[model samples]
Target: MPKLGYTAAQIRAAEAPLLAKGVPLMIRAAQALADHVTSVLPEPSASRVLVLAGAGDNGGDACWAASFLAEAGVQVNVVPVMGRLSPEPEAGARESGARILTEAKPVDAAQLVADADVIIDGMLGIGAGGTAAGGSPALRGTARDWALAVHAALTENPHPLVIAVDLPSGIDPDSGEVAEPEAVIPADLTVTFIGIKAGCLQGEGAKLAGKVWLEPIGASQHLLGVPPAVTVS
Candidate 1:
């Protein structure tokens, strides 16, 4: 079914109450994501998955998902786009046997992207400042390099299924605009949480997010009270 879309702010506001009450939102998101990933895998034991995780809640979701994938005997490799990962995700990934690469070079990223059966794009999410109209925004430092390398690998190989966490990095969750379309990870499937984002239905987001899947993360629609902005069949 086509899912209801909401603005990032609306989603945040709806989640605030649950977060304040210490709901396991991240874990729930990860579990749902892992379940979908497992369902798609041809052979779990032989599959290799790469997660490009940033130091944010979205990245945390990917990490937790990686942990679950690891427990299922999937070889998971995580590349931290930021310098350090958040404590909870880092711990979860390590405990579940997912290898967290401390120092990821361009070659490392290319190799991982090329070898993986699935690539989880968790580098950035709804909070990112999307690209301007005239040109693409510049990504600083290692994040830039990682984006470039991954983009290149995907373009060249075009094999592994790319699954974006929440929203694809470099996408405007509210507007569906992209700062750098070339650098953005084109998700074959985007497993969004809380509510489908408005951005996923229009502009560059529609093209970048090949197919969209919504996971509510146990948040009630009554609590969200988010009216659907648009719907895609």
Candidate 2:
């Protein structure tokens, strides 16, 4: 599909048909992201993973990827934005021996990010809408908010690799617009799934999305009609 400039909803919507056919699109997106996240981890740093999970399915993907990383011996540290995120991926993460960062005192937040070798930015992606409102919006699930707190800390001294699951949080996947993207938490690589959101392909999306790639599970075509013009990626 040429550069269709599709909305986040449209891209995700097109995925519905494929998903219903028992195609593990989420698994592909998760595993594809996992592979990218693994490429940067050195043997020395294989035991440390910092997952900044959001309150959405994208966050779940991050958690799932973390599980894969953990299996490879990476110490996965999952810090959800809210306390207990809905449709949470904690269950899957736990299956891989990953721990969710519970609400803690202010000091503990700093320790988590500093200890992590890799930071998985699972805060938001293409489906992100009213979820990422202000830079520091009210988080749900629990009391302590780790997403913004982590962003603040990472901004000061960012890690070597920031692997965003779908799209970087605070970035519009459809428009590629970043609403005050944290400098401390800029991503080094991004692995988007299903289809490339408009924001991830162009505009500020292009700036935030580094070395973009697709993760389609049995979804080679978006539509079965005349094809659209393509870019020479």
Task: State the lDDT of candidate 1 residue by residue for 74-160, as single tens digits.
Answer: 999988987777798889899989999887786776678778999998887765533432323234567667887899988888899
lDDT of each: 0.81, 0.65
> Please, what are the lDDT tens digits per residue for candidate 2 over residues 61-164?
88888778878777888876645543536788887788877655335657877787778887666554422332232232332245556667777767647777
N/CA/C clash count, model 2: 4
> Model 1 lDDT vs. the true structure?
0.81
Taking all chains together, the TM-score of candidate 2 against the true structure is 0.80
Model 1 segments more than 4 A misplaced: 1-3, 129-139
For model 2 the local lDDT of residue 29 reads 76
Q: After superposition, how far is residue 130 of candidate 2 from its true place, in Å?
A: 9.0
Clash pairs (backbone) in predicted model 2: 47-75, 83-142, 155-184, 176-199
Once model 2 is optimally superposed onto the true structure by TM-score, how far is the C-alpha of residue 201 displaced, in angstroms? 2.9
Residue 62 alpha-carbon offset, candidate 2, angstroms = 0.9
Best-fitting candidate, measured by lDDT?
Answer: 1
| RMSD of each candidate relative to the true structure | 2.8, 4.3
The regions of model 2 sitting more than 4 angstroms off are 1-5, 44-46, 86-88, 104-107, 129-147, 223-233
The prediction achieving the highest TM-score against the true structure is 1
